[model samples]
Target: MGNLMEPSSASVYDGNLASDRVVIHVTSHQRIDQQILVKWRTKTFIARIVEDQEEWIPQFLTQAANFCGENVSRGSPKGSLGSGTTLRFWIDTWLEDKPFYLLFPDLFKLESYKGCLVKDRCTGGGEFSQWEWSWIRPPSTPMEIQQLLTMLTKIQNVTLSNQDDSWRWNADSSSCFTVKSMRIRLQNASYGPTHWVFPWNKFAPHKVNVLGWRIKMNRIATADQLAKRNISTTLSLCPICKAQNETAEHLFLLCPFVDYLWSFILSWCRVSTQKPCNLKDLMEVHQKANLNHWTQKLFQHVILSYIWVIWKTRNDSIFLTKNPSLRRAIKDLKGTSFFWLATRSNIPDLNWEKWRTFSF
Candidate 1:
């Protein structure tokens, strides 16, 4: 092998090549470029005043001015509206979502104005003209009529509230355009729930592996989480001891039940620490245990099993109305984790006796 310790003369820009690979990705997002954003902002000036007058804009900005219309056409508008003057009924992503054509192809073909504004479809903007259900053509068949009526029922309740139409980035919950969310969507078109980031450890049990994924995502349906989602629950407090609000972190780490469990488990492995405050801390405890990567991974599975078993015990106590001792849960974890490591680790001769008395 070549001299491993020798410092070669590779430039610092070597790593930058990875970032350069994404240039095509960034350039594809025309909405983000400041020049393009500015160009689109002055679309009205181009449309009304500078119509057919390329010289009106400086010669240098000709291409930018031209690109604005195309970019604006690409972006779909979202939100509830007032005088639907600015909203496009069909081409723009307004009512019924994913553009009217994609949702109801039949109605899209019959519409007179391909680029008709939302106001054109609505009845009145005269002084204080209230919005009512109105469409131009009567349906040809009973099926078409039923379709129209069904589509109407969705929007009939949509009475205008005197608010101007506003655009929103529908990709995220905040409804604001964010770079990370945009990049993630660009990376995944058919994006659904964020994929759970479970560990790459092959030796971890299925239950523990899935539990780690859920915990990392903070998606465990603790009582506090249920309350946040407006779920009807009699109490938000810990169902076990009724001490504090039951969150994943509290239940998995700091609760009186887990406190004793962790004390014994950590002490068994000679890893000492206070209660972990979050999922991250719990996961990282193995890394900080002064162990090598191999041992750390083994410990990670054990820790995951610890959390998973505790969660299961908590759920059983609540739903099945059963009483569980910490000792029982700890015993369950030891058995499960040992079994998993033995079968999945592919170690030469891993056994329960060795696992139970494992140190360093």
Candidate 2:
């Protein structure tokens, strides 16, 4: 019937007791006076209650206290407080009071805070503060933002260029090209974020086959070898001379057979005989040559095609049901190079018969 306080003892009352200690038997009204009753309790009693529910009390009190404090603080001296302002200000204040701002000297340095503000326009603070907390600082103009993005993208591209894995196996030079341009023609295609609309689904079978061969060549003999003998174990015999070492250098340039092929190709192209001992060195010679742009690329492609064809012929002899004759091999190399050029580029007419006249 009533509430009563007893110091250092539990207050016991009969059903008819008349005091401020009103006990409501109904569960629905238990929370009605809980706040007032809690405030009236002695410090010892409050501590005991806190101890009993310490696990959840802190969070509960924090939220409730924030809601009440904001409602009270935002009340105008001459006007009633609005529901929206009370709710908004409460949440804003609570967020501003979060431990991050209290502990850290620079809130912008924390990735979590930056990410949060970037994702949501809300900070436990004002709108201006929220904007300031974003990971990307506001640019002076749209152009400035674009410039910053461009600079960052350029840096990323440079980083990728410098990475070892980015290099492709450029057979002509036995090195890599920093960039490659691929011509794309679109048919019944849609645009992507970066590239134009092209029917990639309908890729040319020949091109796919060529690409596969390139990838395979790039992966071949990646491991380091101490001697030419180690190379011979992998490649049966010297691809050039069919004698001596079968290492990459011997197979490509040093071997007598390859030396003969190089001489023949160079003479046919009307290029000087400046022989190099290995593919790497041969490429350097080609690079330094006073050849026109198209001519240089054409020559490089021709050399690459020759190497690829030679390797294919070797594989055919070893695994396939046929052996390649010198005359047939030369013909195959010339034909393959011609077909590649015809399909991939427009070039001066090549005289294959004249090219093949050079002997091994």
Candidate 3:
């Protein structure tokens, strides 16, 4: 197929958030691609729903649709009830996690218009008492009456507003959709029991966590990984120790230089500096300590800081200063750990003295 939008006359939008959003206004005679249409609907349906426009969104946008109640939500400004014109009364999870169809299956079966919009059923100035039901028959049975009354109680506070409704994408703080947030969400969803969960510490900077994650995934461009990719390097030895060929395992955990650094960190944390067998063992070292939850977390933070500092020191030795200082790396690790805890952690009394002697 010639480009779907190219052959047809359409206007394209370019804006600040344009990377996350694509708007194409095509001529009436032009055809739209089905796959592209699905993708577009998946991303843009929330915005359409917010605009109070009735549109039939496919259920196969399953992940996105499922997140409508959990990761995304209908929101309105202060003193506004949010419009419900576009949201299906019994389909979309505007009120709760599961849609009303699942929540009240019997009532759903009674609904005359199975796919009616919220605005269609709500007639009296957005009051729960004024619900105009399009049912095959009014609730005659006791169970049906009880369900209707329960539903009324649940939606008593809900009211439509003159102002337009808004969709909040909870994945991002700004409540706007981003590729990064979506990727993280999908990754978390796909994680299995066998999958190695990255030891994420909130006290460490995001970059440090990313590096740790990369190391765990064997995705970092260490010398061995580079060689595997058929990239030539003049020297593939450990940049810090100049001993073994640089790999994630050796560079971060097994190198003599790194072993000494780990020893220093362990001793400072008041733990025995037993040599870790592998990267996994090194990561789990913090958990072996007989400490409280907070202390264990702090120890993990220290370990992550050490790895981050060691990687930086190795890089600087190769590219920047061309000299590797064990003392400098140790100093950087302590400073980074202290700074991260003081700034990112909730430790109110985490001063240099307490941090220096593992007294937290």
Candidate 4:
């Protein structure tokens, strides 16, 4: 199909495709594609529920991602009670790992107040973080007392500081909230990736994966992209070859140097496939090779290593006055790929000598 905003009489965007691009690039910073997060409802939704605005209500709530209270309350509170008038013992997610109610369902059912505040159950009466929790709720029977004792035993090691209860997003290491992370967690909770988990299945480092992602999105700072942005640099010459215009296609493929590298890699893996013409083509060539999962993963690692090492060498040439050579790059690629594959994958039991040689 033509571009979505092509000058069509029946186009919904009124033939203004640039506006669509602008909205996609600028507004949706956290989103991968133009998609909504799967979180059913947030604490902010409680106040917004009373707002009479028609657009305020999300379409996904009733259509696709229905109201799921348990799904929405994934983050657990780490800090102890300060002035926990806002934190509910059962409703809000206050427990460090899972919700307290989920941990002790019997207590949750028999509790007097479902929305009991953390401050209401603390021992000391200070807004400081040093306050201790001492709940001796009157139990009805011996079984209930045992349940209470069990709950207390579980909580004895848990030290409650005077800090205010705050939710931590468990998806990321930073414990910060982002729509992308929330969506990834929710999506993976019930559904995982339809394909391999990682690109090339543990071929390169985190930075290389990031570079591959940017290359796929056409966001890498190629000479053409720079010229388009009015930056003064080579308009047609490649930084590496200084022959043709540098593009994702030419930089990674079609170049005589890359052709040599691919020749070595393909012969090494014993995969008799044509060299891919572009980044996307290179990424998909392994699938078409019809090898088993392990062999395909092996080829992917090599291809990913090639891309990363080439890019790094190209950068070294440009910035460090280091002359780029195919032999040096291939050597670096071998060492780097071995470091990644050996540590990350831990399979095939291939040594450095075997990996260096064409021992496929």
Candidate with top lDDT is 3
Q: Over the stretch 1-360, how does candidate 1's per-residue lDDT look in tens digits?
A: 011122123321122111111111333443346334443443433344333332222221222323444233233225446657666666555665456655666666666667776677666443443343334575687766666676676666454446766555454465543334434444443221443334556777666677777777777888877877888787687776678988887888778887788888877776665556778778777767777887888778778888778888888888898787877887898988888877776776677777898743
lDDT of each: 0.60, 0.39, 0.66, 0.58
Q: Which is better, 1 or 2, measured by lDDT? A: 1
Question: What TM-score would you give candidate 4 relative to the actual structure?
Answer: 0.48
For 1-360, candidate 2 gives per-residue lDDT tens digits of 123232212111112223334222212232333334333442333344422332122222333323333322221011111211222221222222332222232323423343231114333232222222344444445555555455334323111111111111111132211101000001112222323212111112355345324322332442224242265344456544556745556556666666667777787676774776544444444455678765565565556666676667656765684555666766776777766655664434545554345221
Please provide, for model 3 over 137-178, each residue's C-alpha lDDT reduced to its tens digit, 9 standing for 90 to 100. 888788888888888888776767666543444455654444
Error of 2 at 208 (Å): 11
Rank ordering of all candidates by lDDT, starting from the highest:
3, 1, 4, 2
Task: Give the TM-scores of the predictions, in the order they appear.
Answer: 0.52, 0.35, 0.49, 0.48
Per-residue lDDT over 1-360 for candidate 4, one digit per residue giving the tens place of the 0 to 100 score? 012222222211122222221111213333323233322233233335432332222222222222323343453223234456555555554454455666667667677776676666654455223323333465667766777687676645444455655434444466533334434444444322233233535556778777776676567888888888888874456767888888878888877888888888877778888777667777778887868887787777787888899889878878797888988987898888888887886567678888777465
Regions more than 4 Å wrong, model 2: 1-236, 321-324, 347-360
Which pairs of residues have clashing backbones in candidate 1? none
Cα displacement (angstroms), candidate 1, residue 355, comes to: 0.6
Highest-scoring model, TM-score: 1
Cα RMSD for candidates in order: 15.7, 28.6, 19.4, 22.4
Candidate 3 residue 87 Cα shift, in angstroms, is 41
* Candidate 3 lDDT trough over 10 residues, lowest sum: 9-18
Ranking the candidates on TM-score from highest down gives 1, 3, 4, 2
lDDT of 2 at 258: 65
